[model samples]
Target: SQQGEEDPQALSIQEGENATMNCSYKTSINNLQWYRQNSGRGLVHLILIRSNEREKHSGRLRVTLDTSKKSSSLLITASRAADTASYFCARAPQGGSEKLVFGKGTKLTVNP
Candidate 1:
């Protein structure tokens, strides 16, 4: 079964606003990562937080992980219209699966 799934499947905001999304998972994970997809093709890696880490940030992105709760959240600050895209949370398997289970994703629309 898939290990990760995101909540609030859709989001909309103005160019200058921030966007936040949440994710829930079913099992233990080695690490959790966030990716952004433009249109419907390639996925661009954003940030990653290990199971032992509480929070991490990169540029305008912030990620938080609560391993005890098997959950994570991604926050995009100072959003822009170019940031509009589909964002997904993926979990790295605990074992040596060498595969990632991705969430259904949250569609974010930043209107200019």
Candidate 2:
């Protein structure tokens, strides 16, 4: 089964705000990657933090991981309308194949 499943399937935030989402996985994972896709568009790789890493940051994005809990969180700070997109968290199992198994996703709306 796909390891990661993001909760709260959707979120709405005003522009210039912050949005946070959580993901939970069932099995051991080698890595977790977060991606974003605009409506009707291809997904863009946002960030990837390996199993050994606890937290990572890129631009306005902050991601945190907890292997013990098999969970992760993504925080987008000072969000903009351009940040409106669906976010997905995918996992590469520790001893499994390389292809990513993606979550259904969290649809984020940034209201201008």
Candidate 3:
């Protein structure tokens, strides 16, 4: 079974709004990463938060991890139409190899 599961399968919002997505994991992890995928395009690594880190930010993106709850969230501020994409959360196990397990993803649509 998959380790991470994202909530709210889809989201729609106007440009300039903030978008939030959540993910829950089934087991302990070394780190949690978020990725963005555009239609017909490949995935882009967004952010990665280590198990010991509570939150992290880059550009307009913010990521939070709660190991005790086995959950995480991604926040994108000042959304743009270009930000429309599918976002996934990936899990890197505590003692596993570099391979990562990914969630189903949350499709976000930013309208103009």
Instruction: List the pairs of residues colliding in candidate 2.
Output: none
Model 3 CA lDDT for position 74:
99
Regions of candidate 2 where Cα sits further than 4 Å from its true position: 1-3
Worst 10 residues of 3 by lDDT: 93-102
Question: Candidate 3, residue 71: CA error in Å?
Answer: 0.5
Order the candidates by TM-score, highest first — what do you get? 3, 2, 1
For each candidate in turn, the TM-score is 0.95, 0.96, 0.96
lDDT digits (tens) for residues 81-100 of candidate 1: 99999999999979877899
In order of listing, the candidates' clash counts read 0, 0, 0
Give the 10-residue window scoring lowest on summed lDDT in candidate 1: 1-10
What do the candidate models score in CA lDDT, each in turn? 0.93, 0.93, 0.95
Alpha-carbon RMSD, each predicted model = 1.0, 1.0, 0.9
Please tell me which model should have the higher lDDT, number 1 or number 2: 2
Over the stretch 24-45, how does candidate 3's per-residue lDDT look in tens digits? 9988999999999999999999
Whose TM-score is greatest here?
A: 3
